[model samples]
Target: MMHPRLLATSIAVVIWGCGSAEAQTLVLGGRAGLTSATQWLNQPYFGYQRVHGTTAGVAATLELGPYFAVQAEGLYVEKGARYYTSYQMRMSYLEGPLLARLSWPIASSRYRLFALGGMAPSVELRCAGYQTVNNPVVNFFDAPPGTSPLDCDSQRQRHTDRSQVMGGGLAFDRGPSQVTLEFRRTRGSDIAGYDC
Candidate 1:
């Protein structure tokens, strides 16, 4: 029931001069960023609001040539939605993303610009802000007063997600190491048997 929107900034190190005379072919890095999340619900009375979260991860890249490369990352992210001003639906996941990149050097400068697109598959690690109520016969537009708000995890059997990633970045080349700043957007696809 949650579709996430994410913006990330990261820095990576280009590993070079490892007893090779060729250009750098491998990079390793770590990143941490903030996330804003929201969800869509079937109930018309409930209006979802954005909740804040965090993302952290490690990444690796393999250069295929001067202008093309492949990258992979392992990330842990927090996502959810806020409703009713006090109720929050929170979830955490471990994600793996594979991306294809295209890069080119800026004219007469030590900077490179790159664009990337990929897919990330995630497994839910934790979920909260939901409870079962057997009393009063809960239904749409009806709920027991003072009950915990409903979350996607309580309404669905699927605890996994596949998200799409797209972004661009600028890198500063400094000898054997490079520093990169990137902005990315991720959108989650609907999971089977999941509803809110």
Candidate 2:
């Protein structure tokens, strides 16, 4: 969740009073965000807590008009879904998306109300550091977070992989500041296989 204060600031920039045309010609700025994302899983199978983390990164934008622009953003993301009885996992990936942005001006308002949709060729890396765990019971189940010292070590997975991403989001802008809420999905053979 973005803090209320920071949100207010972004909105102020998105709604900056009308600026000189040259000042509007090109916009170079950055953005940071938070997200609640998790693996697609069955709650009945894993009673443990879901994957919870934030994605904060940088972005660059080129405004083509009041209604259209091109955006390129790179975010280090943490994403996963949960399933099975012992679903304990943490993973992270660096994703770069090049997308087309569509925007609209609010009626008689300084802020621009916009919807963004685009395609991103991306990469999903497998974070590493999962250890060979000891199975105490004759009936072997996966490792749990509390089973042993394996709990003390964890790292983001890194590997060679890529995918296609699609997402749509809304943003409010004034001038140099903006607040955006968007959802994007990425899929590749990597998302399906254990090696990815």
lDDT of 2 at 102: 62
Q: For each candidate, C-alpha RMSD in Å?
A: 9.0, 10.9
Which one wins on TM-score?
1
Alpha-carbon TM-score of each model against the true structure = 0.72, 0.59
Cα miss at 100, model 1 (Å)? 0.8
**Candidate 1 C-alpha lDDT tens digits along 1-196:** 3333322121121222122336447888887889887776666876679878999999998775566677999999998766654466688999998887778889979898999988999999987664444453544543435455576655456789888999999988788676888888888866525343
Candidate 1: segments with Cα more than 4 A from true spot? 1-21, 41-47, 130-152, 192-196
User: lDDT for every model?
Assistant: 0.74, 0.55
Q: Summarize candidate 2's per-residue lDDT along 1-196 as a digit string, tens digits.
A: 4689977964564455334465454555555665455433244543434556667667887775576666788877776544343334555777676765667777867666555544454455544222334564332344554342233123223343355566666676656576667776655433433333
In model 2, which runs have C-alpha deviations exceeding 4 angstroms?
1-24, 36-50, 124-134, 137-166, 185-190, 194-196
Estimate the TM-score for candidate 2: 0.59
Predicted structure 2: clash tally: 19
Error of 2 at 54 (Å): 1.4
